[model samples]
Target chain A: MILNIPFSDIVFYFVAVFMVLLSIAAVSSKNVLRSAIFLIASFLGTAILYLLLKAEFMAMAQIMLYVGGVVVFIIFAILLTSHLGENKLSTPISQKFLAVFLALTLLGVMAKFLFNTKELSESITQKSPEASSLIAYGERLLSYAPNGFVLPFEIISILLFMTLVVAITIAKKDNKEEK
Target chain B: MLPSVTHPIGDFVRENVPNVLGYLPDFIQPYIPSAEIATLINIIICMVAIAVVGIAPVPVLIYMERKVCAHIQCRLGPMRLGPHGVLQLVADIAKLLFKEVYAPKGADKFLFYLAPIFVLTAPFLNLCVIPFDKNLQVADLSVAIPFILAMNGFGILSTLLGGWASNNKYSLISSLRSGAQIISYEISFAMILLLVVMLAGSASLGEITASQSGHFWDWWIFKAPVLGLLAFIMFLVSSTAELNRAPFDIAEAEQELTGGFHTEYNGMAFAMFYLAEYINLFTTSCIATVCFLGGYHAPTIGILAIDNILNFVPGIVWFLGKTFFVVWIYMMFRWTFVRPRVDQLMALEWKFLLPVNLLLLIFGVVFLAFGWILP
Candidate 1:
């Protein structure tokens, strides 16, 4: 049975296991910094999985946005708020039980959402090479046809801009009274 | 016919590189997966070639930087080692290799060791996507632009980890500054890259190079009107900031922060950061060459005789020539400009570069919409 499996299948299984282990390491590590690093490794493992799935654009985006942008910001926040070279205590039993319950609930919701998406299942079974091309992705992003995503894309950009303005406003407010 | 003449060696190598597996005995071929083995070998060979290209130029770059600095400051530099001090870098590397490798007592040992390795990996990853010649790229992903940008982010991660793990205040402060500066400048950098992508109509580096294939004026810097030149200048400034070189070297400002993020690193670990800096310089210059200059395409002056003569030279030669020229420009910038205050650095990116980059993008869109690009 193992001999009958293709090379890509073996790679997929390996990457899936790697991601799971990294996720566990990330959650269980006592050191905040180490956990952050483990989280990034897991993100990178997801990127490799995307590559194996032939979603080249998505893989790069995953690396760029998650491992590069968001995690860096989170690390910065951690560095600012916490003392360096320190580790946190392990979780208590009650806290662990609560965390497990929350995680299970989230997983259940996600699973239900995934099972209900007909197009997602269809895409999984019959992938189109052209759908993964950068040009097609760009066109779809900016298009306003029935299946287009231009509205949501523009809305997201505007929302992000608003958030930036608000953040700057709040940050600068402290400086104004002193002046 | 011209391409055939110019890339004959490249074509031959690309064609035959995959057949190394076929040369293995049939008995072994049946035991192993031939296609997978061939791919693995190809990847390994490409990785080694890229590693050599990334690392082999460090000494030359170091020598050039020293000589350039010496000349600027009116002093002799490294005159004793070999002719013109060419062997100085070799001596420096040997000394670094033999030096003691130890983490600070309070340092995060695992992260401290991993930081240099991660720092060195970024440049190699970035270099793999670059088209050194017509048929010489290692991996030509559809999202090559984003992939390169993402690899650059790794540099910041390394700096943060290295600094934080060192258990020193100066390293931590320097790393924080680096994180902020790189993050800020990255926006402008991405915007400039977006301009080139818009002009090329594709994100693939190969396609971007092909888009600029024509006369000397067809290069992206000269392809459009004022927008391209403005974009090119912004590219230089933002990339310099991204590189954390002088003028943007506030993160490692010797006057304040002792040695910056690598303050605790010694010996080979320190050498890795140093070499990675130079390698990043080369890769960024290569990117500038490919995106703004004509990539591997030789210049055509509209004179058939001169153009034909130029075409006879291989693409890699042109590629390297343009790349080194940009590298020289970077070295000149390093020696000429003074480091900016950290606040000034932030202001420069947020107030100046970002707004201008957005305006250029708008203008570029307009120009592109009206089909005003140069032929």
Candidate 2:
């Protein structure tokens, strides 16, 4: 759809700026809460870009699942150390060497793959069709035939199942606590 | 339907903007609402809006609570602060703001501060998808209820974490009880939700409200009476527990737990959590209106097709009115109601509410199969 609005471009630039600011905050905040909040800002900024591109469902899903579910879960986990973790406290375990080294190596390898991929053909960009996220998602979700949801749908479900099991096991009642 | 022009900005520069100066602005328009980007911007707007809306109710509702509580108790209550003690809430907030925010000695400091912000930002973010007035929503998505419910569930994280992070035994104790109550109640609440979704035959909030229009008795609550009544009752119980309001306010049983989970918090951080608790008050009300009360649907009339004509009044007002009513009802329970023990709260969720929600879900599926709603 042609959005003839004169200032949509201005907002897009703001979104980009917001993303960078959030990334910086996420990386640099010594306070974990602040970092998580910045992370949420990053996700929300990304979701807006998604909406601007007419991908409303993906935007909402990013907010709902990632920000709402995943981030909240992580924040709560941080709280697990709440009683004992009140200050700008540092962890005793110093794995900085392995962590920083592996991170740079991974980034380099990913960049290499992006340049060397064999399907280095022309980029494909399609304008989004107009449909509400819920409706479109349900339709795509149910379509498992010729043009199907066979792979991705199953993968999503499998991921959800694994997350469920992992969460329950980790959070399950500890036998030692019972004693 | 509108035609889309995917032409590069430089190509359209001559047609739209007469100057090269407007180049960058023209370049950025087309890629706006694609996916993550639009949602991100919309979420930020919603978060900011919530800060204003969320805080407003903190003072207003606190004063209102005092007045209401006084009436119930046959006393005039505070008449000194502002008009009829209207400024009482303002005074209270002032005191909380100036109060020394101390991380008690030996307290794990980071989680102590982190807890309040976690509890607070949630309500702001959740408010994004709600349509208060038709054009006023920051983001209108089809999966609004699920989105709302999911947020409602996630907000509990802040509550539990806030409570546990304090390291005080009282706070830890409150977190345990509150966490279990929330998780258990949510199961029943979710079941009730599936039932309503089935009955509506649509997942989008806008479509669900649209599907319920007709005469005075045409609301979905009136359409599927049993399921509606059951869902409404269960939703009420769960929301009471979810919001940690009276009868279910295990998080702050001062007599026993010394302000429950918030024992270690003070100052502005504490105030944020306090304000957020009220935002949840309004958020849950909005969710209930969207799901069971036919949202912003106007009642049908005898002579005029009132529902049809009233659709012009913007879907937001009816939504607000319905939501306010729910909020008021919940508020009455909060201020004027008697408290329930922790065990009773647990039993209510596990025994009474869960079975009702299960039954409602089953009926909803059957209703869908019978084609009671439009495909």
- Mark the 10 consecutive residues where model 2 chain A has the least summed lDDT: A120-129
Q: Tens-digit lDDT track for model 1 on B1-375?
A: 001112444444556654765787876665556555545556566778888999887878888899989998999899998998889888998999999999999889999998999998779888888898877887666788998888888998999999999989999999999999999999889989999998998888888999999888999999997778888889999999999999899889988999899999999999999999999999999999999998999999889999999999999999999998999999899888878898878878877787688788879889988989986
Over B265-307, each residue of candidate 2 has an lDDT whose tens digit, in order, gives 8888778777888888887777788777877666556556655
lDDT of 2: 0.67
Superposed Cα deviation of residue A113, candidate 1 (Å): 7.4
Report the C-alpha displacement of residue A11, candidate 1, in angstroms: 0.9
lDDT (Cα, 0-100) at B85 in candidate 2: 84
- Pick by DockQ: which candidate is best? 1
Segments of candidate 2 deviating more than 4 angstroms: A1-113, A116-132, A150-179, B1-52, B100-102, B108-110, B305-318, B335-344, B372-375
Give interface RMSD (Å), model 1: 5.2
TM-score of chain A of 2: 0.61
Local accuracy of candidate 2 as per-residue lDDT tens digits, A1-179 = 22643344566788999999889888767767657767877988998877666665676568767775677667656655543324664544467677778989999999899988855443212344455456676777778777757678889978975774464444334423756
